[model samples]
Target: MRFRMILLIGTSLMLASFTMPGPTTSPTLDRDLEPVVVAGQQMPSFAGVPLDQLFVYAYSGGTWHQIPWQFDEVQDSTIVSSEDGLLDADDQLVFMVADTGDQASQEAWIADENSRQYPRYEVVVTDPLDPSKRGWVYVYHSATLASSVTQDYVNFDEVQALVTSDRYLLGLMTDHPSMDRLELNGSGVDILDRTKIRAEIQFLGTYTEEDLEASRPAATRDGRVRVVIGSGDLIAYRSMFQNILWIDLTSVPMRVLWGRFSTDLSPTASGSYYYDANTSSGVVVDGVSDSVATSPASDWAQVSGTTGTMVRVVDSTEAGGTPSTYYKDDGAVDPTDTGDQRSYGDAGVRLDDPNRQFTFRTWTYVLPPDQPNVGATYRSYARNPLQAQTNEQYHPDFATAPPTATSTPTETPTAPPSMTPTVTPSATPSATPTPTSAPTDTPTLTATPTHTPTATTTHTPTPTATPTTTASMTPTSTPTDTPTPTVRWRVYLPMLRARGSARNAQNGLVLSACLVLGSTPPRIVAEVGA
Candidate 1:
């Protein structure tokens, strides 16, 4: 592929000419981002709206671009920024959801100007006169944050423990989780020579399974440990527009398995192992059964060096983990498939929590191995995690949020005088972006090498359009309750069996500046963590 994109831009300019730190014993941090808001009472037209000009947007294909919004301001619990500027309430209008599936595997979250793919979106708004469907994500309130979008597709380098994304480069086993090698972004071939977690606690009196010969839980009992996410920061949450990679191993300490109590008068029934290491090959992560999953849970492992392929997603199993009999591809095994089925199993992220501690919220994906339907771009944003709601008014704006998309209207997007409309009072993020007729040198990252991924990939909503008198004013009032961001349950839940986390009776979201002026204005690139 063009010499694998010129050896990944010459190994990313030799990884931006080095800077080191992360080996382990902690502190490599940077990417555990988590904080996506829009409050100011959801926008009473954003009342005064000026916390450094505020901006955030995601409504793919058709229009309404502009992504990368940060304005922190937590106060009391730390994160300050009230400088009187406006955008108050608990202040935080942060933003992230760029799990970079690039608009669900190339539907074009724009591909020029700077690069675009505003991923984490879900809007179905269909009342086009009542067929009755609901769920929307179109909040455009801005002072100016456009040029189109791109920045934070996760090139994160925490000292090269690396967290790259355009699809894979990852290598950090620092602070553990079965990753110490997994290259596959440009055929650089590393295809995982590591990754393990085959726990087994047993107990409850003579817990026999023919005496632990790889004791179930997808067997491989303690098959060389791993399934670790970081805390205090090993990357707990990242955002490329919901670019999911959150593994809150509840702040460290995970036991692998340690059996011994045949009955030594039961010293409080102990059996500790908590991650020790055993396996050497690679791709261990076992656990399978739950009637063989559809999407509520799943676990299965198989990999034998093609030098690539790592999707790795496992979630919220405070205990009893297992699902998926097999997925097959890299090495497809089932010699007589003995990884048991289930016997109180667990592959990773299983907690009995008596200090046996375990917590692993999931979402790990890396595409770019020629990019041709890598299992539908990680199952439409890594097993569908959609459920974001807030209302005050979007005034018949763009619509469509199904399977991953919607209808079209085109037009409304103008503001390219450097995004015209700055309230002055800057708080950072103003480098380059006053370009206009774009095309500095063919960028838009070619979007992970031009789209093909399809297992559904919908989302074409561009509704209103053509407007522009500042997008014909539209902003209803009434919606109090402090910035509203309570649409929870994100251990990556396939949209909770098709929508069931609830949050759409209007909680908050107001920025009716309505302006999509000019074209390709979704790239302002300023992730100030604000």
Candidate 2:
């Protein structure tokens, strides 16, 4: 947004009619005396009478003499002089006016004796050519008060003074209560300092609504200044005003940085780490990296040197799944690598210690390559042991008892051989019928029929066996567990690829690796880029 420019021109001249030398022996009568003219430029006014009215005064001999003046509409200037020799060449003239007609009603102002308690007024004059350039003139018709009236509004000049031409300015307007709360909370200062952003705070003391609004037009211009109102409900005001950035100090006590990690690990391992660009610190499992390493490794195999603070903390190594070891620097130090050094520590005893055993270890050095290893390979090995044992026992019994003999069955008298069988059955029936044989034959036939019916009923259960075969098919669901590893790899491989891509995008500046020794505190192994 652009600001309008205004130029002010003040013209004071001695009229030719009043060129006669002063110190006239007799005070010139009203008829012979000529009026002195005072002409100046001012913005058009819509104020009510008496207040909008302009009056001129001349100062001489430590006393002020009021002079009648007429405003010219076409010239936009005020003309003043006196006919009773009151306007002298040695006198100084000043123009006075009220900001509004309401000030004219004050009793202290109307009673000339109490003029010392009258209000003060500031008259603003703008350049006719560039109206934006304006100037203020203070006018006092009575004795000056000990304290001047506080201005409720801010002008364009005030804003221009607060901001630098090249930098962005954030202006905060708040009341005493809100400012006190902010200070007690001790908030927002750090964020501004870290970002190197400029901000100014303005305290509003008993300013009216109109006073606040009058200052907003000059404050809200975009690119010139960003205004934030800290007291009232910012949401309500933000919607009401356009191009003004409103911030609620009570709600947002601090500035938070929000960003997305360019690289993320899948199933996130325990020792995995990331660096915060703003803090220049690496985040590890134990906490932020105490030591910072800075050097470029020409290749992945090259161990770049690092320098910073270091602390000994316990780290669990994936190698043995044990915490019975500590990390010291490996003997692979390079003379050129300045700050790179080793850290050493002892692993504390475990409950299952057999010999009060303790182990000491050194830190391993590894650095990221100048380029990502896209076709890298990894290998792992596993082993299992088996053993078997057996026992045998036997028992024997010997016993040969007496010999057994088989006897031949004798032929029944039912028939001599074949014919005797048929004749015996007929005779046996006939014989029994004579007494109870006939009843026995009928019961035997009835028993045979009942056995046949029971056999037919047993066949119904044969179809039930088919459902048992279908039940075995449900066990197929167990195969779902087999795909778990596949699913894991599917999810894991993409993350690795993404991480590699991110590293490559950075020109292989970041290095991610696990800490050596199964029992050292987590540390971020970072290699700075050249």
Candidate 3:
């Protein structure tokens, strides 16, 4: 999958605009004019008061700190001079509009009031011409000013635009005081080091007096993965928080090898003769040979040499082709078995056939766990038994050939022939077995037999074995079970799941932010201006 890069440009715009009845007047300043009007009406309770009767305060470090201010007597507006550098970049200036006529009212507001009998307004300042420049001011009634006053310092629209433009975003929202230390300790930043994948990082819902709110309709609302972090143990306050990490894997093309098998004989019949048939009339025909060897010559000699002067013969009358049968000693069968025949059955047949062929096949599929909407492909291969003996490698070619046979023989050899042919029969001229048309290799990517997703912690999932195998070549009378090859790739994606607790929430926030931002303890100090 691919993504388009987002570019952002900053522009300057009008600041705050609120209306209230006041005498129009303009203020005189000592410096060059780049005046930013901070005009707003005072709370109705203090409406009739003169501009000199009201004082403005800035909230910083959890306390309302006072700063020098001047009122615009002409425009009838409040003005804060930026020439003295009182407002720095990225400053969450919480200014309170105080109607303090004396020191008593100021002290009461400083002590932190329980009720909101005072009026206050919050504003976030960012230079439109330089969106990165952060500076802001707020206003509240002197009587209503409290330590616990809700702080609305972050602008949701601005943050969403900034992060989405970069394509990938990761953020943390927590009220934990230990967050700064955790960043330094590498609790979160270390995870990012494990991979080279890059993403944009932003701090959200931090330093605001309000508990983190759930803004579900924001840019991060769709296709977002959330992880809750915290200690499971019970604590006084469950500081639960959320960490969101969004990645676009469409650009990351994952090539997965789905399935593979070598061409070879079936597991039970490999390295052994396919047929052990005898003529209707028992006859030991010497020097009979098959066009092809069923078992190796060494295997046939093992039985013939043991039995005195046993002969090999071929029957050309068979429909497909002449198959080799062997003649052997009568003692090949157990003496207690009364049904056994010494002349015509197992004991006197050819051991190997050269004209026979075998086919082997295996199947597999590839899937993306997180992106289910995206489709995946299936891979498979096939080969004949003889080809499998030499080259065990599987290819994508959809040849109709059988899977390669196992290198190591797994089946036991059948018991040696028990009975000898009673009559010596003449050998008929042998005919070669006609070759059958090869099966067409049809490799299909269809998802037959749905697969289950495997869980893994690593970025790449490990391949596992599947139980499906298809082998063709074994005789119908004597069925053989072939073990299917087990070679398939499985993908496991990373995920975090946790219950919402206050402690966990704080941990989640710090951890999530650190993960996205790639900031260390020292860097975090600069990030939050600590």
Question: What CA RMSD would you report for each candidate?
Answer: 26.7, 51.8, 39.4
- On residues 421-497, what C-alpha lDDT tens digit does candidate 3 reach at each position? 00100111111111111112212111122111111000000012211222322110111111111111111111212
Error of 2 at 269 (Å): 35
What's each prediction's TM-score?
Answer: 0.22, 0.12, 0.15
Candidate 1 lDDT trough over 10 residues, lowest sum: 215-224
Point out the worst 10-residue segment of candidate 3 by lDDT: 380-389
lDDT of each: 0.27, 0.17, 0.19
Candidate 2 per-residue lDDT over residues 11-74, each given as its tens digit: 1223322332233121111111111111111111111223223333323232333333332211
Error of 1 at 194 (Å): 22
- TM-score (C-alpha, index-matched) for candidate 3: 0.15
| C-alpha lDDT of candidate 3 relative to the true structure | 0.19
Those runs of model 2 whose alpha carbons end farther than 4 Å from true positions after fitting are 1-124, 128-137, 141-530
Regions of model 1 farther than 4 Å from truth: 1-48, 55-67, 70-86, 89-277, 283-346, 349-360, 363-530
